[model samples]
Target: MQKKYQKISATSGIMTFDLELNSEISKVWDLIATTKGFAQWFPELSIGEPGVDGLILFDFGNGEYEEMTITVYEPQSILEYTWDKNMVRFELVGQDNKIKLRFTEEINEKTTHTPRDISGWHMCLEKIQGILEGKEVSFTEDEFLALFDEYQALMN
Candidate 1:
């Protein structure tokens, strides 16, 4: 899997990543669109409902939750939601017993936090891929920090 980061401007850009998984679309969909499944990789986020205008809860690990709105939804295929000032979308396509998961984030305003967010998402996608491949996955701060540095370099 390769990750693509595009800088549209000093304030806006896009990030895209793709994963080819030997799993059912439904399984991938659950991991991306449902609370329990998403928690396996990204524990801080969860979906509240199953359609557009639904809420995606962001748990701060301190009993506080931020409500993010779902902007698009399609069962076992597409899911898009508001992520802070950006937009995050996951698209799934199945072919020949494998599925391609495309993750895209539209960054409305790139700040100092952009690299951190991108690196976080990069690891989450890898975790998802590992789990789907029947492998146990764990992340360390050092690993994240190293990756974060790599993304931060892109910002420069």
Candidate 2:
């Protein structure tokens, strides 16, 4: 299925994407909230704790790490965190053996890297969906550049 994304705001700097997956809430929760599952779709995540106020460290595999503090954590429902000057949130809604996964990224400022981040998140969501569907996924640099161009057009 083709993923759909919405630009929540251009001035306020927010983007949202919703995904429909044929999976249970618990399984979908683990894919976003656990270190192992994150490694499969997102970045290599290391957490100091497992709940609200916990620290999540995202390792980009280039010896660089970004530290984010968990702002809200509700099991199988919501997970919010601080990322740099912005915030990232995940909300999972389940109905009859399927899940509606919502991802929102709140950007604080528009920088040159804004398009890159937006494109990256777009690809990451696709990866997450693929993993849930028992498929292998990888995002290539060319694909990212294409997405970056698309986001640039959207933003401008």
Candidate 3:
């Protein structure tokens, strides 16, 4: 499925993507909410705790870690957390047997890293979809760069 991206507010710097997956809500929930499921697609994800106010550590396997705090947690429905100067939110909705996932990133300001982050999220979503479909999929650096260029042009 083609992903949809929208600018919630240019002034507020909010951006969002709506993704539809051919999977059940429960499966989708696991992929986003559980540490083991998260590791399937996001190999660097490690959570100190399992709920709200917990520490989410992202280790790039380079001995460097980016820590973020989970601000909201509702199993199988909502997951939100602090990401640097912004907040990332994931909302899941079930329709029949399929699932709809809405991802929102609240940006404080547009920076050089904005497009990079957007592209990364885009790839992540794709990876999640692949996992749900039982397909081995990943994006190369070149694919990311292409996606980054697309987001950069869209932002401009």
Candidate 4:
């Protein structure tokens, strides 16, 4: 599950990851595009409207939330939204007997937090797979640190 990193510019970049899941495309779509499905995995996000320019709220607890806009929506195939200053997109493709989930993040600018954020996205995708496999998975700080190191190396 290694991510592909591309330095698009001195201050911007792109990261892409692909995962093959032995589940229906709809199931994978639900997890990444629906509120209830995200609650089971990435609970911080909730989809408000299921279309372009829709609102996606990021709950920060205690009645605090940040709003993200849905920039692209193509039902079960593509979902793209604003993530802070960057953009995050998810694409699902069904092939043969498996569903391919493609995630891409367009980094607007390079920051000290880039590596940490990249590592977090890596773990999040892994969690999604674990859910589909019905396996109990935990994301620990140690695991994130190790992944952070790996992605941080790419910055150099």
Candidate 5:
């Protein structure tokens, strides 16, 4: 899997980067739809949606959890939804044998950036990239814990 952009939003006006992967839409879709698929990368997700109108709820196990309501689950174009107060959109396009994905999370100014959310998304997308391109991601459970700890530190 090729990583075009991987970093935090250190710029004004744009706090997120656009990451595209090389894979089919079906493979990409499965990563977002199935609980087992995401569980491979997201260790805090105790409950998740595998269908439309489904809600994904996860606790970082710090007596805090975030819940997102599913809004869209179209096969090839979009998967848009509200996770907590943040609005996330995933758009897909087919380029030959590759699936170009755009994952965007638009947050209100009132909403401060939580590192846990940031790191979790980062790891998950990386795993997705690996899966899409037929590469192995070395994201172990302990690795997830370390990432989560880093995020928690940033948040607090």
Candidate 6:
């Protein structure tokens, strides 16, 4: 049920996509707004709650941990949060038999931003795109080490 997907690219202060999915708002929300659903793609994540004061703890078991605070949550409508001072928002627009999922991840320091997080979201967004079309997959974290090494190589 994916209608359109915006390719991810590095920007001066952020990296994100404006995605369109052709699925029920409830179903799509369940995937992104739930712990188990998120763990499907971000295997390193251990979500606490989906409330305003909740925290998303993601640890790839590689000595790195990402902590994000949920500042806003409105079921299948709107979700906003902060990660390392970066504001991440998910705006849900309902359409006929589908919903438009807009994701904007803004970080002040792109050069210091973690590529692992970006790549993880990259894979997650791709799977979300596929899942809505009934061709989804379970992206794993077994590639964390390799991906970390790869990112380091790219940076150096």
Cα lDDT of model 3 by residue, 39-60, tens digit: 9877788776868998778887
Strongest candidate by lDDT: 1
RMSD per candidate (Å) reads 1.0, 2.4, 2.1, 1.2, 5.7, 5.6
* Candidate 5 global TM-score: 0.64
Candidate 1 residue runs with Cα over 4 Å from true position: none
Cα RMSD, model 3: 2.1
The full ranking of all candidates by TM-score, starting with the best, is: 1, 4, 3, 2, 6, 5
Q: In candidate 5, residue 85 scores what lDDT?
A: 67
lDDT assessment of candidate 2: 0.81
Q: In order, how many clashes per candidate?
A: 0, 0, 0, 0, 1, 3
Model 2 CA lDDT for position 125? 84
Listed in order, each prediction's TM-score against the native is: 0.96, 0.88, 0.88, 0.95, 0.64, 0.70
True-structure lDDT of candidate 1: 0.90
Q: What's the C-alpha lDDT at position 53 in model 4?
A: 97
Query: What is the C-alpha local distance difference test score of each model?
Result: 0.90, 0.81, 0.83, 0.89, 0.63, 0.69
Which has the higher lDDT value, candidate number 3 or candidate number 4?
4
Q: Which candidate would rank higher by TM-score, 3 or 4?
A: 4
Which has the higher lDDT value, candidate number 2 or candidate number 4?
4
lDDT of prediction 4: 0.89
In the range 16-124, model 5's lDDT, one tens digit per residue, is 4356766667777667665666666666653366447777777768888777777887766777777666666777787666667777666432234445566667677
Candidate 4 regions exceeding 4 Å error are none
Candidate 6's residue-wise lDDT over 33-152, tens digit each? Answer: 887777666667666777888887778598888788889888888777886656777778886776788776765445544667665566678788787787866556777656555544
Report how far off residue 47 is in candidate 1 (Å): 1.5
Candidate 5 local lDDT, residue 82 = 79
Q: Write the per-residue lDDT of candidate 4 for residues 1-156, one digit (tens) a residue.
A: 657989888778899999989998888888999999999878999998879999899999889999999999998799999998999999999965599899999999878898898888898899999999999878788888998999888865
Q: Is candidate 3 or candidate 6 better by lDDT?
A: 3
Which segments of model 3 are wrong by more than 4 Å? Answer: 1-12
